[model samples]
Target: MFFSLIFSLCCVTAWALPQYQPQYYSFSPTVGRGHGESFASVGEGRITGVRIWEQSNSYIKGFQLKYENVWTPIYGSTSNEETELLLFEGEAIVQISGKYNPPNYIYCLRFVTSRGRSLIAGQPTGNSFNFYPVDGQSELQIVSGRSDGTGIASIGAHWALIYRNDSKALT
Candidate 1:
């Protein structure tokens, strides 16, 4: 009787407590040829800057992202004109849209932030594609894709809720 009473109390307590569901990241469909070459800039911290190298009136040649104070290695080779965007405090990238060419190569990229600011690079040619979080509560967290030796071949985005150093939610 004692053991049954204890077991019943435990089960009731467990069932009464609130269940916390784990948050999973949502991935946007990758766009472009997606050759074997690969690169990833995952969640290190808040994104602080973005630099894109592109041929004049042509495709994206290289890309780099700054996480917190660190910069990821350049994906693809760096040559020709380069465009850079430095984000302000608490700003987050909320949308990504671009164009991809046949065979390979990302033709253009436009990044929109939560503050309504934007950064655009490359030429607006090729097929159009867009990426953003469907969960509404998440922001851009991971940028992964393939890059040919000379230019970006494909790109994908991952979105998740932002967390502070204390593990508190920021978004």
Candidate 2:
């Protein structure tokens, strides 16, 4: 009886374990001196995490994530890249600084899913970044200019999505 109970407990625990599937997408946008935007759409599923990279030397004046009818501002110093592990549903829109007829700027993004699956649409690389959980949606929308709407730069983005998994809700 003791052995049987232990086996049952183990099975139950294994089944309850959270499974994570990671998906990745990359985008290259040529934002010039003015304003620009980039984004990606995900199928049905929950977004567990996100990562963004700015390949250009220019500073990102500001950035925001839009989905459904809500817009969430991304807080952080103007850096080359950023990451977050916030949970979001449906599609996602990434809006960033842009320039009019500017140089070529490259940006990348990654999305982690609750399920242990991922679909990559661009080149994958080895790099370390940080991600945190925040509130937002999972849809693509037009890029609204910065608060000042006067920055000379371009933006690119990549996204990842998972189609299946067994993970608990992200608190």
The per-model lDDT (C-alpha) reads 0.85, 0.34
Per-residue CA lDDT of candidate 1, range 57-144, in tens? Answer: 8899988888888898888878769889988777778899999986879999998888888889999989999999887767788888
Error of 2 at 61 (Å): 19
For model 1, the superposed segments whose C-alpha errors exceed 4 Å read 1-4, 7-18, 22-24, 165-171
Error of 1 at 146 (Å): 0.6
List ranges where model 2 is wrong by over 4 Å: 25-153, 161-171
Worst ten in a row by lDDT for model 1: 162-171
Please give, for residues 1-171, the per-residue lDDT of candidate 2 as tens digits: 999999999999999998773324333332333334333333234323333333244333334443334445442223454433344543233322222333322222343333322221112232223232222222222232222332314433333332333342221
TM-score of model 1 (CA atoms): 0.86
Highest lDDT: give the candidate number: 1
